[model samples]
Target: MQYEFRPSGVCSSKIVLDVEGDIVRKVQFVGGCSGNSQGIGALVQGMKVDDVIGRLRGIRCGRRNTSCPDQLAQALLLYQSKNETKE
Candidate 1:
């Protein structure tokens, strides 16, 4: 499934993510540090969503309370809230 997440308290305006089960397939960030965003996108591919969240959540950008990575984690949580596992 795919999710579009809007970030707050960060430079990135939006994040687009594709995941199958808990593994991430693709990640795209809009309006952020281009190189870092691309790097993050590449690194998270094929990783478990929960694992990504654990690593990325609660990160701060300089003095602020949230970073792009943190926002991505929030996005994953939002995704979890909306998608129920199929038996």
Candidate 2:
């Protein structure tokens, strides 16, 4: 499945994800710190969604409430919840 998410309290504007079952196939962040966002995307590829969530959730950017990674995790969680509702 493919998903797009808007991130709050961060430089990034959008997150795009491709996931298959429990694994992440791809992640892309729009309008953020290029290197960090790209690196985060690369690192999370092929990782289990839950693992990514566990690692990335609650991450803060500077003094802000959330970071790009955290937003990505939130996106995945939303994805999981939506999928769960389908079953």
Candidate 3:
């Protein structure tokens, strides 16, 4: 499934993801730190959605409650929940 998420309290305004079952096939961010966004995308490719959430969740950027990575984690969690509800 392909999902697009709008993140809150972060530099990135948008996160686009492709997921198959529980695995993440691709992640793309819009309107964020370009290098960091690209790096995060590369790092999470082909990773399990749950694993990404575990690793990236709760990470803070400076004093803010969430970073782009954390936003990705949240996005994945939302995706998981939505999928679960459909089953």
Candidate 4:
């Protein structure tokens, strides 16, 4: 499955991730700290959704209390919940 997150309170315009079963295949962030986003994407590329959420959910951008990464985690959770309910 492919997931796209449009998060608030961050430099990135959008986040895109591709998942197969429990593993992430590709992650791309648009309009952020280019290098950092790329590195993050690469690092999380093969990780499971739960693992990614665990690692990223609490990350905050300074005092704003939510970063792009955190928002991505939320989005993934929401998406998973919605999909599961359809089954």
Candidate 5:
């Protein structure tokens, strides 16, 4: 499944994900630090969604309350929650 999320409290404007079962197939972040976002997307490819979330959740960017990684985690959580309701 493919999911798109708009993230708040972060530099990233959007997160696009392609997941198969619980594994992440691809990730793309729009409007953030280019290198960091690309690196993150690469690292999370083929990783389990929950594992990604566990590793990234609550990460802060400097003084900000949320980072791109944290927003990705939130996006994954929202995806999971929405999918769960369908089953």
Candidate 6:
């Protein structure tokens, strides 16, 4: 399934990704550092959502306490939870 998240406290305004079973793919971020966001997207593509969360959840943007990557992980977790609840 495809999920789009509008995240808070991040440089990116939104993130869109495709998830199938445990795999996350085609991650795209809007309104952020274009190259970095796309690089992140490519790196996480085909990775498990849980794995992505584990690796990225605690990352901070310098002293701000949260980074765009961390927010993406949160968004994936939120999406997964909502999907599970629906099923």
Q: Assess candidate 3 and give its TM-score to the true structure.
A: 0.97
**CA deviation > 4 Å runs, candidate 3:** none
- Candidate 2 per-residue lDDT, tens place, 4-63, comes to 988888999999999999999999999989999999999999999999999999999888
Kindly indicate the candidate among 1 and 5 with the higher TM-score: 5
How well is each residue in 1-87 modelled by candidate 5, as lDDT tens digits? 999999998888999999999999999999989999999999999999999999999999999999999999999999999999999
Alpha carbon lDDT of each predicted model: 0.94, 0.93, 0.95, 0.84, 0.95, 0.90
lDDT of 3 by residue, 1-87 (tens): 899999999998899999999999999999989999999999999999889999999999999988999999999999999999999
- At residue 28, what lDDT does model 4 achieve? 88
- Which candidate model has the greater lDDT, 3 or 5? 5
Using Cα atoms with residue i matched to residue i, what is each candidate's TM-score against the true structure?
A: 0.94, 0.97, 0.97, 0.89, 0.97, 0.94
Choose 1 or 4, whichever is better by TM-score.
Answer: 1
Model 5: number of backbone collisions = 0
**What residue pairs are clashing in model 1?**
none
Better of 2 and 6 by TM-score: 2
Once fitted onto the true fold, the runs of candidate 1 whose alpha carbons sit more than 4 angstroms away are: 85-87
Q: How many residue pairs clash (N, CA or C atoms closer than 3 angstroms) in each of the candidate models, in the order given?
A: 0, 0, 0, 0, 0, 0
lDDT of residue 12 for candidate 3: 88
